[model samples]
Target: MASKKKRVKLKSLSQGRPPTLKPLHSLSSKATRTLISSHHTLQKLRAKAVAEGDEAKADAIAKEIEERGGIEKYQHASLLGQSSDRGGDSSRILMDWLVPIVPALKQHASDGRQMRMLEIGALSTTNACSNSRLFEMERIDLNSQAAGIKQQDFMTRPLPNDTKDKFDIISLSLVLNYVPDAIGRGEMLLRTLEFLKIPHHLDSGCQEIFPSLYLVLPAPCITNSRYLDESKLEMIMDSLGYIMVKKKLSNKLVYYLWRRVSFSTKRTCFKKVEIRSGKDRNNFSIVLK
Candidate 1:
């Protein structure tokens, strides 16, 4: 019998909201080993608790499992079964999620400006395009279980104080699923906006776009959630002043690309927009007014 994978939705949020998420706590290495070994028993206990009408007990068990960096985190740990190098491979699934923006990366390299990338919930695995020659990647995970990964809580952390130290790309691959609800997911997106590097200055001839977000999630999350699909996602993000550049749905996962549009460009956004599929990319491109 096959086990079911969890479903998660990608939320669109306004920048004004605040994240009230709880802290993520990682178990010690020994504790993690014990947890992994006792996973079945824990599940059984959780099930019994649920059956006994002890909702509080069930929730506590579930939160403990999640905070200890559950199955997903174990699969990503540096010292675990799979090596992180495999995750760094460019041939991995959806490797070209950044393909359309390769030209921009090349241009930045030519200008001696390295594109900065932030990978949230990267755990011990390499982030999407971490192997790319285009950017210098920095990772943050709620758990310090993995060495060399910074400990940062994305839900509540304030934006960096230095203006010159913003990232050009932020990847939240498979991370938003951890959020509990639509509002929490929306709040996470709101927090994400602070780290984006949008250009304040706009030229009449051509407005320069800023940092873009790369989001990947379980395919079901997109299909099942009313507000998280390609069309609705673009609409939601548009309201928040970002334009959806591309969206792709693969067999196991979904991908989204969003470029930060300037305030001036946003003024013209809702006028007349068209969604047309890309010729060979199997994704849709949005033409904003």
Candidate 2:
């Protein structure tokens, strides 16, 4: 009798989820571990400085942290990967957000303008933007020895130049939460602004619009974080010539779909007006969407 073949049991795929990989820490390289260790050491020093009421020392540490890419240097994929996320629901949320936008992507390639995309903080996945399969994808991460994921810093990397408006979309999923503060997060938005395509052909009433973003950040950023909230984000993105096309504040994550639109025509879902008291400050006006 022929020996029975042993089969490998697989995780459930009924929801079209990516196969679960080994934990990110186990898959991290020695260099990743070293960075994480250094970051933690700095954190301990920072805490001690704060406890000692050494304002100068704390400020110095904060400056150093900012120079080293803020908390992102520490909490990046190099350390937590998707583990910081809620049951790793980020992947599903992003995939769902991305799939619907696929049809909105530019279809034809004039002058060899094939669709491309940048996936920052892509954790151990080949198909970073599962929606744009035809896109010439580039994936970057500080950790995760995933095949094709380059260990590169997205903050400092120069935007693509040779291909003018080559990329049609960028995905920054569960990455912004790693930044230390609101200013750092705003700086991130500023740095990544060059990646989008703002077509001048809008004068022709072309139904085909430019590129957009599928962003996922921790919910605290929108709900209770000291520096960040939905109102602030809207103001920043509006100033940058983008508007939120869709949004979801889930239990663990705040997801947004932002597409390029004319600044004059932008409609912010959340609106507020700051009213000040006599030589003092009044709370902001609330017009909930």
TM-score, cand. 1 vs. native: 0.59
**Alpha-carbon lDDT, every model:** 0.54, 0.54
Backbone clash pairs for candidate 1 read none
Clashes of each: 0, 0
lDDT of 1 by residue, 153-270 (tens): 7775666887566777678876665443344555566566678776554223113334677777657555654334466666757666678766767665677777777533232233
Looking at model 2, the pairs that clash are none
- Superposed by TM-score, candidate 1 places the C-alpha of residue 199 at a distance from the truth, in angstroms, of 3.4
TM-score of each: 0.59, 0.58
Cα lDDT for residue 66, model 2?
Answer: 59
lDDT of 2 at 272: 48
- Tell me the deviation in Å of residue 163 in model 2: 4.2
Cα lDDT, model 1, residue 189: 63
In terms of TM-score, the best-performing candidate is 1
Task: Tell me the deviation in Å of residue 157 in model 2.
Answer: 0.6
Looking at candidate 2, the ten consecutive residues that score lowest on lDDT are 10-19
